[model samples]
Target: MMNYHKRFHARMLFALATMAFPAMASAQDIAATTAPASQPQPGDENLVYEIAEVAGIVKVASIGMDPIKDAAAWRQVVPGESLGRGQQIRTTFRSKLKLVARPADPPTVILLENSSRMTIEDLAIRNGAAVSRLGLGYGAIRAGVAEGGVRSDMQIATPRAVLSKRGTDIFRVEYMNGRFNMSLSEQGRGLLQAIQLQLSNRGDVIGMKSRFVTPGQQVTHRMAQAIESMTFDRDININDIFGLVGNDKLFTMLNDRGFGFLLPFNGASNNIFNGQGITQGEDGVAPFNNGLFNTQSQGVRSITDGNFGVGQGSLPNLFDIFRNRDTQPAGSKKSMNEAMRSIFKPKARPRLNIGRVRR
Candidate 1:
């Protein structure tokens, strides 16, 4: 039965690929083959953050070292210890971390919810003010700026979202498994634009594409200029787009993998968003606006009275997984696996659609 399902999924994906963006797929292949390798990243200057507080099981490791499961790596951190550039910070199940960005004008505070990972990308500080950028590899992070915290320059980029603010504001970005060059994403608060870059297997850019998204919009990524998907995506009226968009690579990938990737692009009939239109956690906490764990489970669902195995009838289906993810206790390890993994490997080439996009 399991094997039958797998074959069915593969066939469905192949059919969609052919029916959707046959032309773009071919172009993507050519672009990928002809693209150059990514250039080496230069070593950045040293910048640092301090651990303001920690909840259950937060782990800190350097980008330069192997996984630190030994007591030493876990014990090395004290509240004032410096977290330099190129380091990774993670929180285990039921854990939260508060980090203070060093030397900032209005001061900056970063909160990492459970099952999240972040990397320090760049930091430039002078005269008690700092410009620090961090990449949210996956999971959720909320950045806080002081009142009047608007910095014309602060930027946050995620696999699916790029957020910037003209004034001091609080924002959150969750990365649920996307592999793409983030540098091409623009920086700003109003109507963030997307730059779709087609990359070679070696991670070099060969071609590019784009779109415009309103505040609170989510965009997924794919390789090449699969004009097929990009084009049809734009035809949906902007207002209707929210209700009808987003049946791209992520949807296929999740449906196949059984993590319940079929989301309500048809609008918010799903209970995930509440009557007031604010996202609610299992605890029924509405609006992840303020707190360490506000959006911790953003891409996950809760599993109540069931489990999400390939068959064991544990989870029964995807929606059940969503239930577990939303209601599960914070830092619950079992619930963690119920989240999305960045699974769009282009070699097998999930079918893509590039519809003609009209502004």
Candidate 2:
């Protein structure tokens, strides 16, 4: 009899690897052969921007480290026009951000200049559509808890597509063949537009390949051109692309390693929220959000029951051996019963015993 438990684990790994293989294999296909960040191409411009909002009287800070460590810093970034479309840009604090203590650089504050509030509903739509396009139905796990959390912290990217988020704002950041499209909520859109304008004024031409819109567009060239013209006036790095869009190469490499990577495209590192959902245990199915160990055990027992092994035969019990650890005394009735039972038990005998019976 083969060990079913071992087989099950093997199958699960095969499934995970099989699913991840294409994503990793595809990473190699999208490699970029370019000079290091130190050297800029003919028209390459360094740019940076930060998205923040104001609430009540004080400024709640949200900022993170520079995504690119050695990349040039935008010491002289120019600000663009404030997104003043009547509605009050409530740069209110949405949630507390996760921070790591660093010795070299201390934490910075996040300032809300003119930004809007983004909702979860807006992002759910685009995530659903994107999964649908990949021919994958929205399962409980889609945007739900992954092996790590309630959702995959993964920011999927293709030559023409990107799905990422900051805080509650999920942005469908896309750029295909020089066309750019960004899908976010009203608040997210306003912030993105502001950042785009800031980058354009700085002579950053990358935004021309992108646009910030809500999801559901069939993707058009006109929209791409319009996005391309939306520039920033700051020194932008390869890392700052996230505020408006993302660089395809950076996304692919991160996906290959099966780790979550989100960066502050703008200067407001405090605003960059990168929690990869909820974490279950090593079981991958166990979640930390609602239930604990007992819940996980019950779920496991349900899956590995009677039908999982041989029919009619019980599963092997490790504790059974310990049941007879303290043997009965020599003359005890229990010992006699055990000894007699073994002796009288039918042994494996030949099917036919004929010998001298005929005599």
Candidate 3:
């Protein structure tokens, strides 16, 4: 006999999953609201291109009115060299903290070291008091206080920034020594991974989360890994590291983090975009009848659609190898973009023959 009860439940669950499509659409709208307005238009259905790419004619839009342009002069936002006096400003990445789990009983601690001599107050993470009267570092205290929680040392400070979590799952954020810390167990790590994927969109750090964890086990492990991975002994050139592309704010972040820019494609040598200012094919100028920055009539696809498949048929297609080699590649041979091309593309060259060749 068929199990009618189980079959009925299975049908009910399938119906529920089908009904969840509307919720998925709403979540996409939320993601769109969080995206920067300066992102480009790619005329594809429900697909927004990243900041760097441009159609044959690039569309330019400012996220917020440029303060310098709005005020008719450069306004002083921050004052000093090291994150100047009025340096604190709102950014896309909010510096807020969220509390995930708290034991029914919270612990406390006391302060140990405060450097009074410096222009800015220097508080050691280890030098804090504790309710259990246990040892807690300055990092732990900073992390706790920043998250608006009590450190192991009993020190408490509220975080200035706020982070938005998509799910009910929560975690802790702390600052120690000079580093930021995040703690998540297996489930917590899954939530953290979701957050990180939304933030950076890279899956390199996948499989790093866990279900079971102590207070600081996962955070401490990640922190140690970050420190050990640094190659401080090797010298790096500041300018060489930060390639010139994207917005100035992204540039600033890259510089602050000691990273340089690298475009996904060697756009510099790609003659596909040549003739940007040509009367005819004679001088290699493109007769641009279209406006460069038309968002409304030819705007980017919104995230409202569940289809986030951008690179498939959504983006503007670059010319094929044969076409590019005969026409576009001609102008790219002696260009300074050779290094860029080689770096952006490290695969073996596509074999081409003068006559017909076997595939």
Candidate 4:
């Protein structure tokens, strides 16, 4: 009986050892894997993008030189965190993320809506021009390039097509399943070009096709199909793109963060009324559209009369408000540029009424 009990005990010990071997091996394997890549150091030349804002659940993964062996795990992103090339970002449902490409003179602002995934394939200053390349795995993103002297080379690659832009522009790209769509906002100053690659069954590139999409236009493509172009419907506003309803906090946050320029206004003129009922041109439109006022009327006119609104000069210009810093609220010590920059700085930012709408 003693011998039999000893044999049984030995058998149980062997079974337990066998069961723990795989777990030990897995632990060692995990330890052998590379650790998460560290955040880019300040003033790093490769540091081209920064997280300006984050809402809801958003995470980022840093892909190392050997993506397979050294890919970093995803972690929550914080505002003002800088990202270099090979950084990938994703958002969960009802989440949003804002990124700024600092290489550009005026900086390019990119908003990634909910359920989106994107990778910063490349971002560098090439020959004094900001060159950016992005890969969209799925979902949607809106990008606005501020007007500047140097033309920027920005390209977004989707599964169906590649959208390229030179210079300042505002555009949105969405990719889902096998469908791809790119739309240029009516306020954009530059054109967007789409390139579609024709590949063989083995994924060998055989030929390529291209199309130029102008402001207020859109291009779309499906799986292995020809690209189609159409006019972008003006009814779709920023609120619609972000799937927000009345008085959404995200909308208010965007305005406070200096991204109010992206919000579309009704009618042809990009004007917003101040509290005093005075119409003011949006700051973004004033710099690119030649002047603070849009002479074009929304109503159809049979006769071409440039003298419609003669007294419109009385209306305040958006830039004028910023240029005249004396008009700022009392006790504000920061300049207009400093105030704008403070919006991105967590410690220096001031709390503003988010419910207030601004164009």
Candidate 5:
């Protein structure tokens, strides 16, 4: 007679089923008058970590600033949920998350994506090592550090930058599309695995130019019109840009309209970054046209991502992507990031000063 509602939902199926962060059932309520604070009261012993892996759409709020009055105050961290220390994990619009701070030996994985917001400021065990300290606060994270025999002190803090465990294996921080992402790779010869990001913005730590990132390899940062020196595009070789989009037909019409992650077998080689080939305005060097692998020099322009526009005469134009499939945006993810932000959005030339015309 022990079925306790299917054993309490098999202990809440241990978090990570996937897809379900589309909360907008109309938000208009916020009058709790400082009353909601107990996202962990059902025997929460500050357990630390245990939501192993989740895919798409997630929510958990043990807020740190206090002020909740809607979205039923977010509460769903199935999968043996046990977290601790002011939790706050979120992922909406094509969600993906994985948190396994420690299952045994040397495991520490916390990969989140899609409109993210992470927090777990400190998980202890210090003096004996294992001192994770996260706080992304915005979006994008990928910290997978295994090779442990014991002794780990992971740390990621970003308002601008601060990622620790410097010997490096894998640790990421992102809040891009606005730029300021940065990769720290000194490894990789012929990538089949990629996670290269380099975006930039400056404010603190002397507006960070480069603050020692080389534990494993994969960094991204640039913006503020690219100040330059992220190691000159880290040797620019994503399989030489997928050997220059090998299988043509406009690369299968942009891999049948997902723009095959913009290029390269389309997975940053395979470390799974997805896409990014931007370089715009004011001589946005190599905005996919540094002789784009010279595709037979049969010129014909019009490549846009500044907001949408594509032309590649003599071939590409592939019927202009059905001219607007009835105002897209279904299944959200802003219609796959507006076709991955106009397939690597970067169409420059807007750096004006009104200078010379000296004939």
Candidate 6:
């Protein structure tokens, strides 16, 4: 009887130990699994931009050290996709793209027009400020920055010049061939500076010259020439600037964000449908008065009537037509399909096509 009781007690002790051992191990495993969650993750402090909307055809490529070699493969972009440093985005004819910065406070919006190629050179939070640098190969982009509370240093670099801004501002940059243009909207309350680089015979930067561009002003520079600053002849129209007259979705998104002041209405005061319809007393009426009805009517007529007036010797006007078109060529559609398909295909080394390299 004693032996039997002793044996039973021994068995119970072993069973309890066995169960407790596993419980102890599980607690350790749980602790190990969750330890990293409290640590800062890699790239957590980096600034990232998400594709809010995409119209027509747009593509993105992962750029490496050698742009020519790494940029050979491109895939179609979709909305909600995130773009980080070392990425390049381009739009085809009749295409437009919208990007909204992550950590959306102090909103930053970027709009890429048709036939534009832009590369994200750097996007990181450094020294307590969000720093961003964009390289524009050829095309137009409109960027709006509202420093809700954080400090921001944003720059758009072109072949000819670099446009830099600190704090809140709405600006547009266009580059073609060797010409560059940058303009600050009427509502821009921040400072904008244009820096032109002087290069040596070996294509090395020797010096830089910078000038401040005030609100409601524009700066233009041509290769081997001085920069020209001028005031806008008339009230700029946001619809015309972004080719967004018919794009109700994008127009509403921007307008609701109080970006209407970027371009003010220009029409007769007596016109019943004045700019008031859009401004809505946000920043008060535009400095220049204009009838919203007339502006929109002209935009619609230009698109529906197919009267782009491209042959009128205005390169910007020609690009505007391409940006505002509702339809793309059949070839573009086919290529877009192929690009999307390539994403799922097996990895194959890209063949280098040495045509005009945009970088």
State which candidate has the highest lDDT: 6
Better of 2 and 3 by TM-score: 3
What are the per-model C-alpha RMSD values against the true structure? 26.5, 27.5, 29.4, 30.2, 25.7, 33.2
Q: Which parts of model 3 have CA positions greater than 4 angstroms off?
A: 1-26, 29-33, 37-181, 184-194, 198-214, 217-359
RMSD of 5: 25.7
Over the stretch 1-359, how does candidate 3's per-residue lDDT look in tens digits? 34565555544543453355432212222223333321322331121111221112111222333434543332222211121111111112212111111221222111112210001111112222112111112223212222223332121121211122222123444444534444543443222311111111321211121122233344433433444466465645443211222243235434654423322123343233332332231123222212332222553322323334331333322333334445544557644354345445777867766778877
Of candidate 4, the 10-residue stretch with the lowest lDDT total is 25-34
Ranking by lDDT: 6, 4, 1, 5, 2, 3
- State the TM-score for model 4: 0.48
What does candidate 5's lDDT look like per residue over 1-359, in tens digits? 44565444433321111112121110110001111222333432233677776766688876653325656767667765767666677787787777776445456666788888777755655455666556665788876666666666565555544455543445566765444364543451111111112222321112223334443544444432243634465533222222233233344435444543444443222223432333332332222322233323554333332213232223333333434334565565567557655755788867565887445
List pairs with backbone clashes in candidate 4: none
Worst 10 residues of 5 by lDDT: 24-33
TM per candidate = 0.41, 0.16, 0.17, 0.48, 0.22, 0.49
lDDT of 6: 0.64
Model 2, 163-276: lDDT tens digits are 332222323343335344444444332112211211223232222132333423323335544555566544433432212112232353255423223322343222235423
Greater lDDT among 2 and 4 belongs to: 4
The Cα error of candidate 5 at residue 99, in Å, is: 5.9
Which candidate would rank higher by lDDT, 3 or 4? 4
Candidate 6 per-residue lDDT, tens place, 1-359, comes to 96566556644544454365442212222222222212223554767899999999888986433335655587789999999877788898999999999877558999999999888876766666776778888999999998676677677778767777755478999999878888899999876777665554644444445667788988787422453223334444443432222344235535654545544436333334334434332234322224543344554322333334432334754464445333546557665555545544677767687777666
Which candidate's TM-score is highest? 6
Which lDDT tens digits does candidate 4 get at residues 30-62?
111212323333443443788899999888886
Candidate 1 C-alpha lDDT tens digits along 270-325: 43433233354334433222222222345333334333343223334466556657
